[model samples]
Target: MSYEEILLETEEKMEKAATVFSDELKGIRTGRATPGLIENIRADYYGSPTPLKQMASISVPEPRMLVVKPFDVSVIKSIEKAILKSDLGMTPNSDGKILRLQVPALSEERRKQIVNQVKDLAEKAKISIRNIRRDSNRQADQLEKKSEISEDDCKSLKDEIQELTKKFEDKVNEYFDKKQKEILEK
Candidate 1:
């Protein structure tokens, strides 16, 4: 592949890694209620497992309360079961038509655990970014060996890849820090 293509692919992969990390961070509880925490839960809609967000309308009527009204009220029980099966510790209070989830305040110990989880996720994202850089560097070297690019060009490509890696790693760190502060302070 051309140098431009290699660089663009590397950058896209790094961006995807960062985006996934950000999405995961949204699921971590921050002593507040948010639709994101439960939107991805898989509920049995008919014979298929569907995301809760698609099966229902999840809203935060209050800072600490989530109201989930299923588009098909018949699926309320399945949604409740899904919520219970989720890793989230909260239980849903269900009526015949809708469900209410009470977002409890995070205890100090729980907050610490969540922060640690964030750290782990951030590390994983950095690792992904590094892997993409390695692949891009290898491709550049191959291009150099084939005489498709000069030695200096390969070196420049590797340097550019390294810079992209650093930029993405910093972005992941920034997301982690912001999440950590939110979890600990709230």
Candidate 2:
């Protein structure tokens, strides 16, 4: 493949890594209610397992409260159980129909802990982007060795790939910083 193709592919892969990191950070809750926080919960409905989002309609009735109304009222117990079992550290209140989750404000220590988790996720995303750059650089070298591109071309491609890596790494850091602010904010 041409160097341009290689660089484009590298960028796409890095973007994917960043998107995955952002998605993971969504599961880490702040002091407010967002559907993403609880939708990921896998509820045991009868003998089948399903995501809460698929089993019910989740809404934010208040800034701190989330209402989960199941399509089938029979699954209420299981949905409540699944949420209680999740690591969100919140309890679900059900009135035999809809389950309400009250999201309490996080303690200072808990916010710090969540920030640390975001840091870890950002680090992993950087590592993935670097790995992609490394693989792309290796491919560039292979092309040069096969006489498909000149030695000078390979050097330029390597430099370009490093630039792309730095760009994506910065994007990951930006995401972490934004999330941290959200978590630490009241």
Which is the leading candidate under TM-score?
1
Best by lDDT: 1
User: CA lDDT, every prediction?
Assistant: 0.94, 0.93
Off by over 4 Å in 2: none
TM-scores for every candidate against the unseen true structure: 0.98, 0.95
Locate the minimum summed-lDDT window of 10 residues in model 1. 86-95
Candidate 1 collision pairs: none
lDDT of 2 at 127: 95
Candidate 2 at residue 21, lDDT?
A: 97
Cα RMSD to native, each candidate?
0.8, 1.2
